[model samples]
Target: MKLHELHINDFKFFSQVEGDSPLLKIDGNHLLVYGENGSGKSTIYWALYTLLECSFKKSDDEVRKYFKKTGDESLVNIHATGTNNTYVKTILKDALGNPKTYRVSRKSSDMSIRANTDIRESNMASDFINYRVLFKLHSSKHSNKNNLWNWFLEEVFPYVKKSSDPCLIEFEALKEGPTKFLDLNGNQLFPTASLQDAPSDEEKIFYRNYRDYKQKWVTWHFWLETFLTNITTRANDLINHDFKYNFKIGLNIIKKFPTFQATDDKIKWTDPEIIISITEYEGIQNPAIKKPHTFLNEAKWSAIGLSLRFAILETRLYTADLKILVIDDMILSLDMCNRDVLLDIILNNYVNDYQIILLTHDRFFYELAKSKIAQNGIANWKYLEMFEDSSGTFPKPLIIEKTNQISKVWQLYHGKEFSMAANCLRKATEKLCNAYLSRQERINVNYSVKNLHEMLEAFRTKGMANGLNQNNLIKLIEYKNRILNPSSHYDIETPLFETELKRAIETIEALSIEANINV
Candidate 1:
C-alpha cells in the first residue's frame, strides 16, 4: 500500500490541516522529511504511527496519555476552543490502485476515537521503528523481552498455531497428557499387577486412561525435542544472517560474531528463552558473552538491534506487499560514515520492497541523503521541509534541486535571490572551515560555535600554522566581512548588485579549492 496523503485535525500541533493542505503529500512510497528539533517532526511521526498501527483502538485515557501535553491529557490543539473534534485521516492506494480512506476521530465527549476498520491483527505496526525503541533493544531492557518473543512467534512461526498437521497434533496430545492420568480427586492412579489379574470396572477404566496418557506423553516427548530443535535451528540461522549482514555493512564493531541458543530446563518445554552468546573457537577465543547489552558498545548494540528488527521484517509471516518502514531519527548515535552505510543498506535492500518514511533532524545527513536518493534514481520519493507556525507544523515540498552546498549557493545567486544566496554562502564557508580544521587535526578548534565569523577566525588561527593557504584564508575572511556578514545580519537600503554577488561567490569557490574541498 502507498500512502498518498495524510490529514490531521486538532491533533497535537495540527489544528486543522486537510484537503490540499495535507500534512504530508506522498509521492510514490518514499518520503524524506527534514525538520529542526521541536518543530513537530515527531508529531507527524506519531501521527502516521497512530494511523497505520490502528492505535485509535486504545482507550481514551491511554491515547490521551500518549498524546498528552504538559502533563495533561489533551491531544487537541492548545489553540483549539471547546468541543472541537480531533482526528487523523489517511488515504492509501492498494496494489491494484484502489484508494481507501481511513479516519480516526474523537469528539470532546468521547474518550477514544473510532476507526473504520480493525487492524489490531495486522503486523504492520511492528515495522514502526525509532531511536527510543532501538535504545531499548540496545540496552536489553526487560520490558522489551515479551515484545521480542511475540515478534518472533507471530512473524516467524505464524503458521505453527493454525496447523493441525501430525506434528502439531502430537504436540497437543503431549500438552494434554498430564491431565489424563489424574483421578477425579486429582490423585494419581496406578495400573494392576498383571494383565491376567481381574480388575474392577473403575480400576479397568483407570488402567485404560493411564495407558493412553503414558502413550501420549511418550509421543509428546518425541515431538518436543524435534520442535525445540527446529526452533533452535531457525533462531541460529536468523542470528547468523543478522550478524553477517551487519558486519558486512560496517555496523558491527565486535571481534566475534554472536550466535543464538534456545535454552530451558530439560523437562520445561512450555517456556524457553533465547540466549545470544559469542561464538567461540579454540582456547584463545573471546569470552562467551550472553548479554550483548553488557559486553557490546553502544554502536555495536545499536547495530544488533537494527539487524534484529530488519531480520524480523524480512521473515514476516505475510508477504511484503503492504509493508511500511518508519525510521525516525535512528542514527543520532552513529557517526556520519556509519550513517551513510546504514542508508545504503536500507535503500538497496528495503526501499523498493517496502514503503519508507525516513525522518531526520540532522541537516547534513538530510542533504547527503537527498542527494543519495536522487542518485539512486528513485522517482517516487518526495523531499519535504517541515516547520511550525502559529497554525501548527506544516510540510512543504522542497523543490530546489541543488544537491551540494556550493551548488545551492550558486543556484540562489543566479536566480537573483541575493539574500538567500548570502545565507547559503555563510553556511558553505562554515562547512568548509569545519572540514579544514578537522582535517588539520586541530583539537582546540571549537566545533560548537554557531557564528560564521568566529568559526572562520578560529579556523584561521589554528590552521595558519598548519598547511592552510594564507592567501585564500585572508580572501575568505575579507569577503565575509565585506558582503556575507552584512547581507545576513542587517538590512541595506540598496540590494547587492549581480557583480558584487558574483565576486563573493568567486572568493568562496577559490577558498574551497585551496582548502581541497569540492564545491
Candidate 2:
C-alpha cells in the first residue's frame, strides 16, 4: 500500500479559506519536496508522522490533544479560531486497487486505531529520519564516550524483534520488567518466606525463580550481542561500498545486571548502553580509534550515524502493506559528493521498496536531484516546492506542485480546459527548444524575434545533427502544424479536439525525453 493523497486543513502553516488550500495528489508515486527554511517543509513531515503516531495511541484524548485549539503539542494554526477545525487526512491504496481513507481529527479519534491492524502495521513498517535524529547519534561531549542507550530504547528497540521468536520485543520486554521472576506456567512468582524458615517446596521454588531471573538477563545480553554484531557488519559494508570510506564501525553492548529487592516488589537496574568505536584502515593495517566523535569530522560522523540507523531500519522492516521513507534534510552536513552518493543509494536501492518522501531546503541539491531523476527516466515521481506566503494576516505555505510547464499542461488538460492546455503545451515546446539553443550557444540577437516556426526549424536542424530522435522531431512538426501554428500565430478559430490536444501534449513530453531536456 501507498499514500494516495494528503490533505491538510488549519494545521500549522496550512490555512483553509473557503477550500482554497490545495491537496497534495500523490497518486501513489514518490514525492520530492524543496522548500526554503521556515517555508512549512517540515510541516509535511510532521503531518505524516503525527497521523501514523495516532494509530499507536490507546485513548481518543491522546489523539485529540494534538488538534485542539490549546495545548503545548497542538499543531493548530495560530490564526485559527475555535470555529476552525484542524485535521489531517490521507488516502492509502494497495495493489488490489482499492483506496482506504484514514483521518485524524478532534472527533475522528473515536473511530479507534487499536482495532485496525493495517494502520498499526504500517506505522511499524515505515521509517522517519531527520537531521535531529542524526544529531542524536554523535552529539556526545569529547571527554564522554558515545553511548546510544536512550536513543536505542526510544527509537530502535521498539521496531526490532528477536529472530527466535517474532512476538518477543526488546522494548516491550524491558518496559514490563522481564527480569522479574516468573513460574513455569508464565505466572509471576514471589518468595513467601526466608530460606531458613520456609517449607522445602517453597524454598525450592524460590531458588528456581532466582536462577530463572538471572538467566533472563543472560538471554537478553546474548540477543543484544547478536544484534550489535549484525549491525556492525552491515554498517561497515555500507561505509566501505556506498560511502567509499576507509573506516569500520565497532559496537559493544554494556550489559547492566538487574538487582532484586528482598520484598520482591521493586526491581531496579540501569539501562544497557552501546559504546561505539572506530577502526581506520591504512594500506591493510588497522588503527584503533577510541574516541570517534572527537577524532572524526562532522561529515564522517554523520555518515556513521546514518549508516547505523539505516542498518537498524533494514532489520526492522518485516511485513506491512504501506512502507514510507520520509527524510527531512538529513544530509545537510555532508559535502556534495557524499550527498549525491546518498541520493543515489536512496534512488537506486530503496525507491522500489518504499514510497519515498524526500524534503530538502537546498536549491542546488534540489535541482541536481531532479535532473538525476529525469535522466534516470523515473516517470512515477512528483517534484514540489514550498514557500512561506505572508500576503494574509498570518503566514501560510504557498506550495507549488506543478512548477514545470509539462506538468502544468497535464493539470489543465485533466481539468477539461483545452485552450489553456494548448497554450501551456506550446510554451513547454518553446522552452524545450530555447534550452537546446542556449546549451549549444547558437542564439544570436535575431533569436529574440523568431517565432514558433523558426524555432522548430532551427531545433530540428541542430537537434538531428546532435543525435536527437528524428521520429519525435517529425511528431513535433506535425503537432505544431495541426494545433500550435494556426491557433497561436494566425489567431484562427481552430476547434481543439481532446484527443488531438492530448496527443500533442504527449508528443512534447516525448520530445523532451528524446532531446534530454531538463531545467
Model 2 reaches what TM-score against the true structure? 0.72
Steric clash pairs (candidate 2): none
Model 1: per-residue lDDT, tens digit, 23-133?
666744588877666656766777766754443343555554534443565566676563555677667777687876666555333332333223332333236667665
Residue 382 alpha-carbon offset, candidate 2, angstroms: 0.6
Off by over 4 Å in 1: 18-20, 55-74, 94-98, 107-126, 140-274, 280-287, 319-322, 390-422, 425-483, 486-519
Overall lDDT per candidate, in order of appearance: 0.56, 0.74
Candidate 1, pairs of clashing residues: 60-111
- Best lDDT goes to which candidate? 2
lDDT of 2 by residue, 1-519 (tens): 888889888888777644523368888999999888988898889888888778767688888888898989899888899587787878888878798887778876435653467777777778888877566655553447668676676556655656523223443454344334444556664432243354555345566445555576688788789898998899888888898888887888887776554545656767778887765564344466657778888777777777877887787655777899899998776787778887887888788888999999998988888988988887789888776665457777766676678886776666555665677688898898888875434454755556787788888888789888787787788888766754553432244477778888887888787778852
lDDT of 1: 0.56
Off by over 4 Å in 2: 17-22, 108-110, 141-143, 154-217, 263-267, 283-286, 403-519
Give candidate 2's error at residue 63 in angstroms: 2.2
